[model samples]
Target: MSGDLLATDIEAYLDAHEQKDLLRFITCGSVDDGKSTLIGRLLYESKLIFDDQLAALEADSKVSGTQGGDLDLALLVDGLAAEREQGITIDVAYRFFTTDRRKFIVADTPGHEQYTRNMVTGASTADVAVILVDARKGLLTQTRRHSYLVSLLGIKTVVLAVNKMDAVGYDQSVAAAIDADYRQFASGIGLDDVTVIPISALRGDNIIETGPNLSWYDGPTLLEYLETVEPVGAATGGPMRMPVQWVTRPDPSFRGFAGQLVAGSVAPGDAVRVLPGGQTSLVERIVTADGDLDVAVAGQSVTLTLADEIDVSRGDVLAAAAEPPAVADQFETSLVWMSDQPMLPGRPYLLKIGTRTVGVSIAQPKYKINVNTMEHTAARTLELNEIGVCNLNLDRAVPFDPYEVNRDMGGFIIIDRLTDVTLAAGMIHFALRRADNVHWQSVEVHKEARAAQAHQKPCVVWFTGLSGSGKSTIANLLEKRLFADGRRTYLLDGDNVRHGLNKDLGFTEADRVENIRRVAEVSKLMVDAGLIVLVSFISPFRAERRMARALLEEGEFVEVYVDTPLEVAESRDPKGLYRKARRGELVNFTGIDSPYEPPEDPEIRVDTTTMTPDEAADRVLRVLRERAILPSAGG
Candidate 1:
């Protein structure tokens, strides 16, 4: 294969088809994973670069690379100066190439675990991903993370390219072992039809030609695989996905909406429905920049004129007439946190899903998956690189499908509202509806009527304390007092309430906040029932307590700070949680593994070390009376 295909018909072919049939593939690997070298090798061996391009690469290579002469593939895509200095891929560099069969666009992304977000950007539109694992070393933690994210971003095909096989003596057993491990992880994540091939990108073994060193291996060479690899599937199922890019008026006489079809297909005169506002229209024409077309398939960018202009705008999708996406204001999502800063729940951010961008809040952290063990642990908050499930509350919901089923509409990005930095990338699970069974029990009266019935007035007594600060004891006593007084009352104790009511929840900062929010809502309902509610849990963050207060009517929720000195709480160690926390036996444990942010101006403060449980209960009762949420115990 002479590197002179540019002189042949290949050049003209690429120029013609790249306008419509460009399929992009990106290579991702950690620093020293040979991403740039692999690409440079591909381009060089493929005869894609001209003499001048090769000369420039050689000249630039002398000044940039670590060894000081060979044009490192890393230099080709590491366009940033910081990246060159640090010797890593930082930005998503778009590279172009062409094979005999297809025009190609490649986005070589970064590999450092911290730079995982770059992978999201590159792979967002990728049809195929080539993930590199060092042949001698096998799969690392970052390997699994990258693979998981590749699946998350909806890349349909994955090539587990085991590079540097020569380093391991072209050992079949080593390659087979790594391949087996990757297959297990990929299968566990439900990644479809993965291919693993062993190759030495440096020595050109099994890359473009058959290597004599590996007679034991019988597989298609990398170039042969690329030639035959079909990027898109034979079928794309259901509902046309046309993300409106712009509304164009070439002439006032004719107006059309333009965008690319992410999936499905559209034909002239086909019935289409526009969302998030449902309005039906007929497709008058499928217009391309060059001319009008009768039909367009998935991935073809085209414009269409509606037979009648009822209403349409950018950010709205023109879906198929039947089986339009479900409109939702809330959704369940699986999020992979990529930012260094921890995700702030209850805070607003811009959610960019498809062409639509809406404001959203992190409402619930369902569970955190322990990647190493593949165990689902309860989550309260997601830290850097943590993956979890959460309920995303959008200011205005859009129609969506579960990520497992639809990649175009299911994947989304959360950008920090303040910084505009991309925070996390996620997949949608389902929409949340108010129509779901209300856990709030039957009431013969309305909320106002229920409030009137519990003459003492209903309110939530939210307890804030260290792990062993006697919160549950005081709450139990307070509940007994309210129940004895014949006042409608309920105690939402931590361990007890969690058993059935919140058995599904786990202990992460996001989950902890979610746990409190659910508890607060239940407390709010009980309060509306005109009950005196005692919520005895260590509601840590001040932000969460303030939110609880905001949910209640004026003076209806009481925030109590149970200030037991850390030393004293540690000494009492009733649950041995502190000892475990100290020895690092716990993960993300507050007051030890994590910093516990204490409250400043809580409504009531009780020094549990000095006050008896009865005294603490009395102190809480006093606040309830102060708010008129309770009468004297005898009343």
Candidate 2:
């Protein structure tokens, strides 16, 4: 049961099944897309059906329950009455069988837009996805959908089984056109590895045998493809990853940890590391209900005892000490929205990473990917079934690698904060690397020492406004005057700070919230060191400004609103951004595209179009003097 296993064990298991191979493939397609029929044909022609299952299919078919059938294969596969009546696969109905050469596990996934979630569930752990497309219909939207989802699910080997070729009179020309179109569409949306096979489940041509009708094609038949396509055990054969399901210390008789081996192999005597806590121990023994196995590979559920006592608990992953995933409080990830409710800022949801569940807030939506075009819309809120990139702030650290690198640690689920429903399935995209600041570490003197050297006092001159309202100009002039007056200070202007301090960020609503959040935190830290901070931002939300004020000393925060009217601010067009916003070229724009909530009561109100930048700056400095945050008006 150690890290390495003899290849014969796997080969022998498949051989003993009396079938072609070890892996099973399931066909997922739309309703009346021949999903059930193709599966039925595979089993029927392969002669795997017992006398009773065939009898049940015939009996159920002849009752005149469904319209289009002497035998509607949908009836044979769809076990539930609800499913048969509705004619859709709601849940994953698994069917098992073995052929002369291999074993199979067919997970019949539903073919509806609403149940794409279920398709994801079925295909998540599948080896190969046989995405069926009707020959006459060519590639449809759901065809693109499932193809995209399979790429997301890490199912690389795909069989584009073109069914209902009989409808096109088994015409090779029509099949070829459909095949070319499908291949082109699939390739356009990350399905380059797909193989299109022409098959007619209804007629049984190219199913088990190559019929005389379609002689132009020389590729493997459906059964031939299933028997030969190598199963991907590579993912399952990675570094050991067992998400701790539970720590079995019942009655304390035998202190052990229990979990399923989500990836790789583990055996007794292998050194394992308990993650999020870096505790290392030697595996003492492996135990399961089915006696003891020397070793267990991926997909096995087993309990283990360590040679030494340690704090190994549920939600902790056990892995080989050499390769452990990243453990952090925060991570960037891609998400597919499943809930009707759109995500929001500062809203907490429970995040399930591997076996670990912790509260999380989507700090920001990086971009929303358009399903049809795969185009990304700069997103603040994600809608139902929409895929997007988001920055999630996790409450606890989790061991994870990028989804493309490691599946077990990288993938996660988000449960709704209120309803407790699973809202999204996410794949981590590694934490954002902080951009190197050439000036970050190098210093002539410490900030506190510099503040001590100039004793006049240090505080923030916060200017809140709508864009292009002279916030930056006023901030710059104020910093210049303070510099001339010999007061110790630095200007953290809106545009300058954005380009320098917050260049890693963007301008969505969530980005706006985070932009304010970050600016506030940095300003607070600056005030603590007694250095005057000049902050000018479109810190539009008065509530957020108030929160920032709450973080400061009683009089430390100064809010200066450049009260230029929306018409005037729009006319200024500091960067032609307003014009773009007006044209709908930009979304979440402060004045035109989005709401800009101004401050009700600011420390100072300077109408930018009415006053000079220097005058506005002087007025702001006067407010600081009046508040006694600065030493004196004439100091």
Best by lDDT: 1
Per-structure clash totals for the candidates: 13, 11
Q: Can you give the lDDT of residue 367 in candidate 2? A: 89
Q: Give the per-residue lDDT digits (tens) of candidate 1, residues 1-635.
A: 21244457787655655554556788986567778777877877777788887787777788887646866655666778888788877778888876666667888888887777777788877878899989877888778777877776777688888998988899899989998888888998867778888888877788788679878878888777766787544246567888898999778798889898877888988899999999998899998878989889886899888998778888898999887877887888889888887887775578998888998889648798776567889866788878898998887858777776677878899997657888898899888776355456776777768766666777788888888888888888888887777778788888887898888877776667767777887888788777778888887766567667767888787788888988888899899999988887787676766666677777888998789999998988887787666655455
lDDT of 2 by residue, 1-635 (tens): 21122244765654455434467566787667888777877778766677998888888877634535576666667887778777666777778766655678888888887777777777766789899989888778777777788777777788988888888888888777877887787777666677888888888889888898777789999888887787443357778888999888777679878989887888889999989899999898899987778998887889988899889878998998787666776777888888776665655578998788997878657788766667778866787777888888777777887887666778899997546799889888887544222235566665557556676566677888888888888888888888887777877766777887788777876567667878888998887667888888888766567667866776677778889898888888879998887788888888776678878877789987779988888888787777765665454
Each candidate's TM vs. the true structure? 0.68, 0.66
Which RMSD does model 1 reach against the true structure? Answer: 7.8
Question: What is the Cα-based lDDT of residue 110 in candidate 1?
Answer: 83
- True-structure RMSD, every candidate: 7.8, 9.9
Q: Which stretches of candidate 1 lie over 4 Å from their true place?
A: 1-20, 66-71, 232-237, 249-252, 433-635
